[model samples]
Target: MKVAVFSDVQAVLPALEAVIEHIEAWHPDMVVMAGDLVNRGPDSGGCLALFDAMRREQGWLPVYGNHEVWVLRCGEEAPASEGERDIRRFTDLAWQQVADQAERLHGWPDHLCLHPPDADAWLHVTHGTMAGNRDGITPGRSDESLAGKLPQGVALFVSGHTHRAHQRRTQGMDVVNVGSVGSPFDGDVRGSYGRFTWRGGRWHTELVRFPYDRERAARDFETSGFLDQGGPLARIVYLEWERAELLIAGWRERYQDAVLRGEITLESSVERYLRTIT
Candidate 1:
């Protein structure tokens, strides 16, 4: 079995288009979008539209990201103030943009037992680790932490949400993070993705990076009206494209301080950081 895995599109339509073009060229049996399909970038509608088009054309599998959760829950119960209404409007446009082909999963099962007969073993996919949500797994974490959560019988575990491309092996499983496709934070603006091959009872994972038009993506943000949110979002996006380690390190420092002070919960901290940056 050959599969393509990616995540964190975050409204960069050109980047998304580039990735989809690559996926089509590769013709993988399955495509997995690890999460964060919308929010952050100026073009939420464009992001959702790209996903919807992919779903119709390729029938890809999508895992839920925290950003997706936020967009979905926006304005669901609370009354919309003017400011909230604007936010909700953007979110609704994003949701309606992808309504044609949005696939949601509560959690990834331990194993994907059903695969083509040619496939060597069952395939597994998750947005992050099996133990927790988006924050549970990251490229900087120790291998021991990963080895502990990986299932015993699965041949391969594929994930994203950390926005970094990495491949690690523990026990009998090949653990891979396909990295981000649209909104890469892997110290490079180039989009990152992964290709997996199952052969002879072993899985081979390869991290692939391709150059996309970051200037164009940035331009999309500017034209889409998110530039007015202040320069931080745009700066963060640009810096994230250039150097993800720095961004992650800065976030880690702030998050640790907030945690030590008990000033905010983890979820709230994450949300706050995202709002500030994106």
Candidate 2:
């Protein structure tokens, strides 16, 4: 069996387009989107539309990620403070883009289990781990720490959400983080995905990194109205795409409480955070 798995295509249309073209050329037997197919970056609606078409026309499978969950919750949750409202605007924009497809996204499963014909080994896929969709499995974690993250009796565990691709062995399971299709946080700007093959009674995996039109993708941050309407934190998200690294976590750590308390404005906090990065 030949399976292709990818995740974290956070609405960068160019990257997703390029990756899809490549995947079609590879012609895997099954294509699975682990999650985070929307939100962050730009062109969320376009991304959702493209993937939705694929799932319907091409039989592609999907697993919901934390971002999808957050998008759905946006309709039910009210912010406790203005600062939270500011921070949530990004998701709000995404929600507006994807609201028409809420029921479809809600139906997506959180995990996938596959059994290759005539093979003793089975495969599992999820956006993150059993702990939750936001809890990612990454290379920085120790093997012992990852043991609990893997489900038992599966020969291969596939996941994304860290946006850093890696292959590891823990608790007698082969684990793979397929990386990001839109903006990866591993300091590499290329789009990434996993190619898995079942042969010779075992599974072999490859992490494929492919370059796309980064300049065009960058232009989308403004052209798609994401930066203008996605609120104060949208610029930070654009920076993450440009830098291909994480800034939100550190930014929130340093400024969220201050912004919430009205000690510092959201714009001022963002400006201060920008100064810290190159």
Model 1 misplaced stretches (Cα beyond 4 Å): 77-120, 230-238, 242-278
Q: After superposition, how far is residue 68 of candidate 1 from its true place, in Å?
A: 0.9
- Provide TM-scores for the models: 0.75, 0.96
lDDT agreement with native, every candidate: 0.66, 0.90
The sequence of per-residue lDDT tens digits that candidate 1 reaches over residues 49-144 is 667667667687777777777666652445244333433444555555455544432343322333447655666776767774465456678876
Q: Which candidate is the best by lDDT?
A: 2
User: Which predicted model would earn the best TM-score?
Assistant: 2
Q: What's model 1's overall lDDT?
A: 0.66
For model 2, the superposed segments whose C-alpha errors exceed 4 Å read none
